[model samples]
Target chain A: MNKSERLFQLVLLLRSRRTAITAEAIAEAMGVSVRTVYRDVQALVLSGVPVEGEPGVGYMIRPANHLPPLVFTPDELQALLVGNRMVQAFTDQDLAKGARSAELKIRSILTEHLKQHAEQQPYRIPILESDDGLREVHGKLRRACEQRHKVRAIYLDEKQEKSERTIWPLGMIGWTGKWTLLAWCELRHAYRNFRFDRFEALDLLEENFRTTSDISIAHYLQSVIGMRDPG
Target chain B: MNKSERLFQLVLLLRSRRTAITAEAIAEAMGVSVRTVYRDVQALVLSGVPVEGEPGVGYMIRPANHLPPLVFTPDELQALLVGNRMVQAFTDQDLAKGARSAELKIRSILTEHLKQHAEQQPYRIPILESDDGLREVHGKLRRACEQRHKVRAIYLDEKQEKSERTIWPLGMIGWTGKWTLLAWCELRHAYRNFRFDRFEALDLLEENFRTTSDISIAHYLQSVIGMRDPG
Candidate 1:
């Protein structure tokens, strides 16, 4: 690699570990002579970079130092790209958008070569099949729950009987190829879980509901699934 | 700030922007002498870092460079602590544990001073309530969904009728007060959403399902919600 490239690698090596890095160690890692390592160290220090310690004692990058430019190896880049794609695959609409936005931000930070590779190899993960209608209702319910709005749904039970109820949505849970809504049912006057598919119709009520203060939807779901009382 | 601190700040400034940075620009930004910027650049380059360009030409840290340590400022740490706590509050048991694990990992990477401060501060965000019998089930369901296992749930509809159905769990969506499950029902041979509370019983079958090859759960939900067929 070129001098600049070697210098960049040195900075990365210093940042990766918690302890001080000796110039000899740097030379060994980079397959360069100790003299070259020494020269590079001098260049970094002269450039107003905050590297601590002497040549013999070992070089340390202080924690307070701002991160140098990020450089991802090919594997790392692929991992990120694939992970972002997975997030987009499973998340709600807004969340999917956020994932795309994050990918763009990363792209903006990448070097030309890395950016080119990223464009050439677009990573995408697939999702499972399910009812489109249920997914839509689920999305709406999630938003309503976040907003603490009341939701009205015509729900069907095991007996194939249907009824309407107003609920304060807290979160959602899935099990056994089924989806459930965890909420405080105004009609039931207690916390309840409603099946999403069983709902004949769903309506977002104009009236807003009180949201839970302490726990998040995930935590609440945990408690319900575990059969534990929040109190 | 000390010289080391100053250098750290300079690196952060340059890393924040992916373009070329000049010594004069660094000096003006940090309100330091250009001579000092020159010294810092020399130091960085001498340390075998990959900073491109010379005194007159602008400098840029190459992308091949390694990232500095994962150091978090006090404010940033506080934000993470708070956010993690919030995640812990609402996530299912497994996820809560995962959150704690991540926090511990973060702590391990911090400097002694930051670690001490983190311990002393003991940042905690409270959660309001927990659901009964949901956490464990949620954990199982999440695993099933991840493993692509078939699930069977004893479900109750609006008429207080109960029935059992086999499903392929797709994903979970959380609303304000409740949790919902999305899946493909074997009985209906279509996608369905179910409520966690309505499940009288849930079972995870030994058979594992495969996620669809192209469509993600989010895309399916969007299309379905928009009254479009996923196929």
Candidate 2:
């Protein structure tokens, strides 16, 4: 086995054990030399896997180390890769960036022809779906949602007329090909959703939605669930 | 090594070569016994991995297989897992189902303690963000976009005023929390986006956009890119 694969195997062995497992046991179990076991354990500790105990003594993974090193079968990885490509094909800037970074990280683990395959993927995210101001608008709404701030905007209606409005920014949602802002529209005196492309102008206010009333993202979520039909 | 890992390593070795590789060579390459390699190969072929050739003869993977069986490293799996959790937390029914299925498939390959970790995940996707009507609405838009159909709707604007409109449906885009439809509005004679929540009613027409006009999704995409700041 390669060193990376061996190191991964070491991690699995250590994580599987509750009490301290001796280096000799690990070496025997992994079919590697004792010195190699010692060296690999040191590397795991140095890499910060929360493996406790020292060389020649024993190694035990702490229980609080919730996110142990992960591994995905080929099909699982393929699904993720396919999902990322789908996102890049039809989603916003932030998610698109996340997908690219995810792809890069996945590629790093691949080797030889598989690595080459990862580099030269069969599917291509078409150079389609762009809205000049949508990315910027997403940034604005994202910040507003994060900060619990209110926003004011000049919105155009179906009549091709503009209206001034104040809204409590909730969060942004992306459909298959467009972005929409979910918010509490103060002008309409209710929660409303506005298309990202429809916002003629937007700005975040100094006032936060927290001080205004009991309205919140949690409440909004519950409201949606309640809207389901019983029939 | 576990059967799955060993099988994956076997696939990797087989994929690295264009010619048929012997079982003894595969055993030596993966640092496992020849019998173990034979058993793993049987498992792989049984699982429909498309690995070909007999034990005594040699093994080889055909080149025509576009997406060679995928295997995700620890970090790649984690990112995908995190993403799936995020979807269940915030998105609609269709995407939510995709994320759930993705999570299940990823968990299927995990072993021992890691499988337990996958079950009792650290992150809990709180039951927040709901819209019972959204899944149905999303289904409609998805079909509309796929079929390239024209639709008519009674839309309520910010003023709560209703307008009858005929539209050429292009696609749907989701923001952080909602959905929007990108369409060519016949009334205003321009590209328009309608919030799913504000649609008073909708109907799929006898008209298909395929034979209608030359306005392609490519054209709509370019219009957005050209909307960038001129100054």
Candidate 3:
């Protein structure tokens, strides 16, 4: 094993442990002598690894995360890669682009020789939806929710019937392949769920909402599973 | 650090390296003497750590995922949290519920101190759709795609017109807020993207498909973003 890899493994073991482990036990575990263990421990401490212990007793890692961002283990790299790949495949173009860039940055840090193992992923997240405008709509809804603005939209029903209505926007829900906007309908005098695809056009109103009157996202969560699309 | 942790680090370094590292190099990197490195190498050998070396040469760890599953750095945990939270907050009830449970399980394995930091996440995934049926539809379509079965559905058009059509199911794409089925429509004689909510009823046919001439998911991804619902 290379010195760098051994140091990384040391960080992992120390970080995972809750209590200190004895030098004799550590020596036995590593298949080394007591003197060797003591010297290694001193080396780690001098190099700012925060390894704490005495010569006779034992050693343990500090509770705080003092390591730099680039100090990652092989498994950590795998986890990050799988996650970024999943995001790239499932989300809109903008988010996918972001994930791709992040993957490149992560790859750049893996000490030149260790790069290959980290780059060649053992698993892959399959590509799914690739909508161009989904993230744009997401941004708008997010703004509306944060500003508590009322919104008016021309909506199309399953029968292709058209209806124009003003709604008090609450939250946006993203399904695996679909998106829905939760709101209180001024026309129906009740809570309504609007699908993003059904909206032909939308305009954010200048007015803010009064949360005390209608159902909030939190309240809606506590009530029941009301996911039936009221088309 | 404890001897066990150091030993583990040594193993990690060796496993990731393509070439052997010299004892002097190991000693300098670990901040220890050459004699200490030699003794540690012997200890690791006796304890069945698979540390390979020679009298005047270097050492390396065998290629293996032999490290315990619990070995995780703080950043890896953070990556897992962000991914799972995105799935929980954005997807439907079933996936969200699954994510919530998984977070709890991952937390259970952590040391008590680590548990506190993991539980009160810096960010939150808000509940969106509370539908109990979204998961069921996802399952059926998944089954159809995997089995390569032809599926018939009572589809609702954007114009609200109802039409019964048979389709060769290709793949299901799960967007953050949508669920779409990519298939070849018999009536249209072309590729079509069908939204899950538009399916009034679905029936999987007892027929398997033979791929010949059509734009596949990979091809579509490469050529164009054909996610438009041809309602």
Candidate 4:
């Protein structure tokens, strides 16, 4: 390896770990003699890279305030594009707008070639339905989830039975052609999943709820993993 | 920046562009004298990095077979996790499985800290319904889209009128709580969108279809951007 390349790689290796790397380790990584490692490190220090070396301890790089520009491979860019397209198509307007904004910001920082690559992306998202009649409710529930707030609603069951319920909104789950709001039902004194579209009246309550380890989305998903129709 | 950092930055600048960078341009970017740039370029070549140079012309690095490891910030990782979660929740079983496999593979290559961050991803996708009753059809159409194959389907319209149609499956779109297949209908000799769930019977034809620029997902999306209920 060339000295310039080795120097670049040395910075990367140091940046990868929090602990100081030993000189022996550096020598091994650089495929050089111990004496050469010493000389190269001296050269690096003279050039003004902030590498700290202690006599018998080791070497470490102090964290820099500014980071280098982030670069992504073509495949990574493709993944980001496709993922954002899915989010824009499958979620409410708020989240969809966030997705679009994020895409725009990411593109702004990309190189010209990558910017064109992103524009020529083959995947496209088309809104097939004019209205799903649940964007407002989805947004409200999403906010409730984000804020750890309670919600009050009049919901319908599978049997078409209507009832008023107060719940702690945990997370929103999208099944095929359906939105299910996973929450902790205060009435049931246990976790429950309610069909989002089945709400007759919905209101975001002012009261915030404290989440225990047992009441998170992860816990709820774990509880329902092997069950049939958790909702 | 120190000389080592400047040298590293020089390599990055060269890599970002396809055209050879002039010494004057390199000096401008590095805030150094043209003589210093020349000395540095000579040092880089001597150190064995493949930088090709021509006097009074420009310099460029040949494409390297091996690339540095891809690194992502915490926000990028979070975006990936959330996007994969949405895909897992809303798509067919095959796609859901693909999302899971992707998450696993990504985590495997990530740094230990990043792997931990990925595992602690708060977003969750819980399947509320045991069956959407369309996973099989979704998989079929997705494969058809991937292979550029024609599909023969007995479809039901809004009025319950049943008819057979031959379509070149261009792409699959997931709207809120619905999946729509965008295709070119051979019967109509025009682009069309079909409700994925509206298929009474579906079959993938052995024949592959050629996609023209005018009949692509981009064209279909452009044609329906302002239309309501395109499906």
Chain B: TM-scores of all predictions: 0.59, 0.59, 0.56, 0.61
| Deviating ranges (above 4 Å) for candidate 1 | A1-60, A63-231, B1-63, B116-132, B157-161, B213-216, B226-231
Write one digit per residue (lDDT tens) for candidate 3, span B1-231.
445445555555565455677998777655678887787777677655677877566797665444432223333444455555565543334444555554555454455544664543322344445544655666577667656788888999888889999988776655445668888788898888888778888999998775563445554544566443210
Task: Note the Cα lDDT for every prediction shown.
Answer: 0.61, 0.60, 0.60, 0.69
Give the top-scoring candidate (DockQ). Answer: 4
lDDT (tens digit, per residue) of candidate 2 on B13-96: 676687898888888987888887788776654333456686467987645344333444443454466456445443345555
Report the number of the highest-lDDT candidate: 4
Order the numbered candidates by TM-score, best leading: 4, 3, 2, 1
Candidate 1 lDDT for residue B160: 91
Q: Per-prediction fnat values?
A: 0.02, 0.04, 0.06, 0.19
Angstrom error of the Cα, residue B229, model 2: value is 28
Which residue segments of model 2 deviate by more than 4 Å?
Answer: A1-69, A85-95, A116-122, A128-130, A211-214, A224-231, B1-231
Report the Cα RMSD per candidate: 16.6, 14.8, 14.5, 11.7
Off by over 4 Å in 4: A1-70, A73-75, A109-117, A120-123, A127-133, A223-231, B1-81, B88-122, B127-166, B187-231
Q: For candidate 4, lDDT tens digit of each residue in B55-140?
A: 77799875543334445565565565666666655555556654543444344345768756555533456543654567677778
Q: For residues A21-87, could you state the per-residue lDDT of candidate 4 as single tens digits?
A: 7889889756798888887777767665678989878998776621232244444555556666776
Candidate 2 lDDT over A113-207, as tens digits, reads: 45543433222234244543566676677668767788989999778799999998775554434556767889998778788778899989998
Ranking 1 against 3 by DockQ, winner: 3
